[model samples]
Each structure stands twice: as structure tokens, then as C-alpha cells.
Target: MAESNKHLPRLLCLHGGGTSAMIFKIQTRRLQWALRSTFKFVFVDGPFTSGAGPGVLPAFAGCDPYFRWLNPESQTAEQDQRRVRQLLSKVIKDDGGEFVGVLGFSQGARLTAGLLADQEEQNAAEGMPNWKFGVMLCGSFPPLSLSFAKMPSTKPSQGTDEHGETREPDEDEIIHVPSVLVRGTLDPHGEKGRRLVKYFDPETAIAMVFKMGHHLPGAAGDTTSDKGDTQKIVDAILKVYADHLPYEELKAPKTTVMENRNGQLSA
Candidate 1:
């Protein structure tokens, strides 16, 4: 199965704050297994090192040297934004100009939303390719500083007044790319996750709620119910992928999911 997907289109993966690419790869092994036939995943680390994030310990113990995208303790916002922009450039360049999708967890998911929004506002002359789609898992509301970093300010004085606060993104600034938003019913950030959907095109966005906490659907023990939820997510992803393919490519038979008597879904 792995060998068959070696040539599949890639999905660039971003880990949550306080986790490294290695840990995220291990964390999402099951999901990768499910989607192995459709997409290959590329995991990348954040630039800044940090402590472990929520739900990272115990399970990921001994996997030291966690990381974060932004330094909340930093006093200079502009410097932080500069580093983030650099990371964005590096990731896009590393993608080799292919139409890569994205999947992110927690803080990474928030950053994913911000990146899509930024892609929407960036000029074509800038040469930044838009992400094909996004799978945001348990993400919180995007930080305004990051989400609207590249967007032009609507207020006078270059989108900021004497207070130096950047203006909010207009409705047009919201991204329209296909997306699957995974929310955890037990996560404290449920409300924030709901708010994050407002940043994407509602028409192309699909939101799913799992019965777990601040982690992937099947991470908690991988029970039958969890597997069912994960299968649902996989189905949603495959459906969106097929829907976005060019008509000629659609000639290939589309994948379908079936629900068994045990109430489990299978592809």
C-alpha cells in the first residue's frame, strides 16, 4: 500500500505548537494509513523551540525538543511576523511548485487558516501558489496578527491608526479553497473552532465534530467509535478531492464508503 502511494500528490502537514514533525508524524500515523492510497504527507517543524503543548505529554514523553511557530512571549510583533513569513516561503519552495494540500492540528491548524487567508490576498505577481485545500483539525480562532498579516488595512494610514493596530480582513479576504474542518466535541476550543470556520468559504467548507478531546479523532484508544469517526473524516476528504478534480480526471471511478451493520464506515 505504501509503495503504491509513493507517487501520489502530497499533503504538507503542520504539527501543533510544542510538537515536532517527528511527533506529528507518529500522532497522525493512523490517518496517514487511512489516506495512504490517496495522498502522501510531508511533515515540517516550526522554527522556534518550546515546551510541550496540551495533550502532548505522557503519550509523547521522551520526544523532547518541541517547537512553536510564534513566540507569544516576544515583545516585537513585527519580528515574529517576519520569521513566520520566512517559514511560509521556505515551505512553499520546498513543495516544488506542485498543487499540495495541507493538514494541521491545533496551533498548526490555526496557522493553516491564516496561510489560506494570506494566500487569498497575496498578488499573483508575488508568485506564491495557493494551497489546494486544507484539513484543519481542532484549530482555534486564528490570531488576527497572523491571519491578516499580508492583507491591506482598510483603515486610513496604511490600515493602522495612531494605535498601530492592523485592520481586520474584509469578507473578500476570507479563503474559498475546499476544506474539511474537524472539531472535537470535548475540546475547550470548540467555540473558537466554530469561529475559525468563518474565515473560510462556507460553501466549500465541511465541518465534522468528533466525540473526542483536543486530538485527532482516533487518537484516543482507536476504538470502534473512534475508527468510525476517522472513516467519516477520510470519506469527507476523498469526496472533496474527487469534487475538485478536473472533469477529464473524473472519468476514473470515484471511491465510495459503505456503512456496515456494526455502524462502521469503510472505503
Candidate 2:
């Protein structure tokens, strides 16, 4: 952590299942390089150690250490959330900095979404940080047990009908923060990702898609001889901070505005 970076807005980075902060740092090296000067990233390891399961072997092949936010079979969603809350409390207490946003991939993304949903209901609770933005890569809706589905919708219906009968309000769970959702066109979780993005208020959420697979694409995987896909991810995140975050001094990098197309903006 550089002394200069200490003054920049901080982003809490969460890794996916079967991955550690180290692995995720390696995976997003390109994006970090691009945004290093603008944002300070704090990568945290998950609470649960990797266990024997499908994809765990290949995902952690030589990676002696790996982690997950929770193990569904062994722990309940509430237990996992409590652990997350404790970890975040410690981070905020010891880091002496406020987190402006969060960036997560895969399983980590699911946890991020869940935490935001929880914060909507628990903002007044002690030791919780109110994140201004979130960037979810290949994320899905948290499981029903996580209670995100049970959160009350923040957007109420407009005026009453002609007969003075108030229209029923839309009952969708809303995440009140600027968010960037990145998904891969070829990823098997594409449908789930779309569902999760739809859960948020469309006006505040930006959906971006690439032609790659499940993995986060970076400079090492670039073959187009142009700006790598990770650059686009970084750009989207910076845009969210610039347009919505309450940081007066942070300037958004000049770039083309991304439009949502077919539920996703191309990278």
C-alpha cells in the first residue's frame, strides 16, 4: 500500500469460491494496474476453507490455500452473513478508512449482493459500512436462505388510479447504489447473472457483457491488439464512482458512455 494511495477512495475486493485474495489479485492484475492510481483496493480472504467438491480440484490445483464465504452444506446463510459482518467491522475499525465501494467475482459477487441487500435493512446497525457502489462479475442472486429475496422493495408505486385505488407497488428487491454487472456471453451462469442484475433498479445498474467465458479476462488473455477486457471493467467501475459516488475530487476518466443492450453492454 503506497502512501499516496492512502488518500484515494478504497474498494473492498472479494474473491470467488476456491480462490484466495492472492489468486484474485493475480486474476485482476490488469484491472488493478489501470485503476491503481485512482482507487485503493483492499482484498480480503473468505471465511471458509476450500472443500472437496466439483470444480474445487481444478480451481485450486496448485493453490495450497483457497477460501469461500460459506459452505451451504455445513453452514447456514445467517451464519455466513454474521461472519462477513464481523470481518467487515474489523476491517473498518483497523484500516482507518471508509470503503466507497466493493468489487467481487463469481461466488464473491453473490456475497456482495447479499451484503448490500442486508445493509439496506441494517444500515442503522452498529459496525456496518454503507457502500456507495458495487461491481459484480459473473454474479448470481444469493440463495433464498440469504434473505435477499425477502427484502422490501424501496420503490413505491406512483399516484392512485382513476378510482382512487392506489396501485400496487412493485415488490422487487432494490439495491440503492450505482452498480456495474459484468457477465460473459458464453458463461453458463449468464441467465442467473441477468436475473440478479434485473433485481436491482435498472436506472442505477449498468450491465456489461464480453464474448469470453467464466474467467475474468485480462491483458494476459488479450488477443485483439486493443484495450483488454479488464480495462473495460475498470472503466465501468470508475464511471460508477464518478457519476454516483460522493467523492468530490475523484474525476471520471473520459470514455464513451456504455449503453445497456440486450441486458448487457459489450466490452
Clashes of 2: 0
Q: How accurate is candidate 1 locally (lDDT)?
A: 0.71
Top TM-score model: 1
What TM-score quantifies how close candidate 1 is to the native fold? 0.79
What number of clashing residue pairs does each candidate have, in the order they appear?
A: 0, 0
lDDT at 196, model 2: 73
Per residue, candidate 2 scores C-alpha lDDT tens digits across 48-157 of 78753223355557875788877657635556556766776677677778788888888888777866766665642247567788889887654122342343223454
Off by over 4 Å in 1: 1-6, 95-97, 123-128, 143-170, 220-225, 247-267
Tell me the whole-model lDDT of each prediction, alpha carbons only: 0.71, 0.68
lDDT of 2 at 76: 51
Q: Which segments of model 2 are wrong by more than 4 Å?
A: 52-60, 122-125, 143-172, 219-226, 245-248, 253-267
